[model samples]
Target: MTEASREVGVVLRRRPVDNPWIDHLWSPAMILDEVPATAPWTVLSTQADATIYYAGPASIELFSSDTANYRDNLADGEPRIWVALRRQDGGSELELTKVTVDPTEGEAMFESGCDVIGTVPMPPEIAAWIAAFVDEFHVERVFHKRKRDRAPGDRRGIPDEGKRRT
Candidate 1:
């Protein structure tokens, strides 16, 4: 981590929704716990209490996995940024669940109770931030390719050399 990099926490707010059609649904919203104090980053938009601010040069890390769903975006082309928010047992602690560039993996997290609060587009500033981190840390990983096992050629075991046939 560089002196210019700061860990900006994502805070999630959950409010109950009472709908006749849906049994239980909670609307999730996100806001930065604190705005990053850096250059080239400014508050672009603000809704109610959530503020969408432009991020300056920073560092971010993606989760590591062998699943294709996690690597497809990185392999295909430029990856998209998805910020996941999750709360446990209706707790107050808002967790920044996962920061991923893979759509499939992000969807899976959403389905598993992690609300995708925002999908940040890779603007030049954001892209450069991610690029710096990736350049320093992201390494090309070789996937393990599974080979098909050979079928059992003979069902019966080799007969004992001296055993008599029944």
Candidate 2:
């Protein structure tokens, strides 16, 4: 993919907790090829790989939350950063092919054995490219509120029998 069309960001991780005095918890390590840098992401401790990038000082659009997946991830107690990647050849449409955080989603990409080159700050050009992709693809979804049902009220008392019947 051309540099102008590529969506990029930095994948970061914390220094393993083996040292006594760690200056910084997180450090950028690799460039993400597919995920769009939309909003200013907070530094998180992803048990897997985490990403942080300059989302340009523009408004970010978001989609509907995957509640089930979110709950499952929370229940699993292993935090992760979800990275989605797409590939387009020549003039063909962009096809989503990988997600590093999801094993099943990016099985093929994982099997390819990609390596991390090194850490670097998010480049301005790459940030702009990701911003463009986010502007084009990210859609604003309305949050739907669910109504709660009222429980039925039952107020009845049973009389105790004085003697047992034969």
Candidate 3:
């Protein structure tokens, strides 16, 4: 693999929730462990001021196939785990992607498209600092993703040719 295409491991713990939408998208039981709240400097240095939707420590380290077995059991259509890494420079570039579930080695189960969840640029030092702080563990749980709901009415103002009022 080229230097830019290299892979690093990371874990994403879903944030706690009261919103039905957010709650449906993830399962908290899958978390490997609760990071101690006292390590602010470590947490701050790594995560920085990144925008994470979930309430907990957002990104973590990726381990073995069985590490995220909980994600495998999750029902279809939930928002899968996504990780974004800032480029060495100031650009907000997403370097890697994976599902929260563990896949068998050599098996191509997870596929991530290029959708950036955030816009801020993260420095390498900050990214590296965060990378060092996460701990890895094995666990699984069924997570959910909120389905899209339709708006109150049709947005199209102009009627079809046959339906014109005149």
> Residues 1-166, candidate 1, lDDT per residue (tens digit)?
2322434433333333467754332232332333455443245555654554343332334443323443455544655556765565676444455655557765676577673356544434544554455555555767899976657875355676788988
lDDT of 3 by residue, 1-166 (tens): 1111122223322344568544422212222233444322222222332322222344333443343332342322342333332233444322333323323321332233333222122334433333332223333447899866667875565466666575
Report residue 101 deviation for candidate 2 (angstroms). Answer: 12
Question: TM-score for all predictions?
Answer: 0.43, 0.27, 0.19
Q: What is the lDDT of candidate 3?
A: 0.32
Per-residue CA lDDT of candidate 2, range 1-166, in tens?
1212234454445444556664334434445444554544444344543334332222212222323332333344443333332334533222222322222332444445432112233344444544454455445558899965555653234345585656
- Please name the candidate that would achieve the greatest TM-score relative to the true structure: 1
Ten residues in a row with the worst lDDT in model 2?
55-64
- Winning model by lDDT: 1
Question: What's the TM for model 2?
Answer: 0.27
The whole-model lDDT of each prediction reads: 0.48, 0.37, 0.32
Off by over 4 Å in 3: 1-3, 21-166
**Candidate 1 — which residues are off by over 4 angstroms?**
1-6, 9-34, 37-59, 63-79, 91-95, 102-104, 115-118, 133-147, 154-166
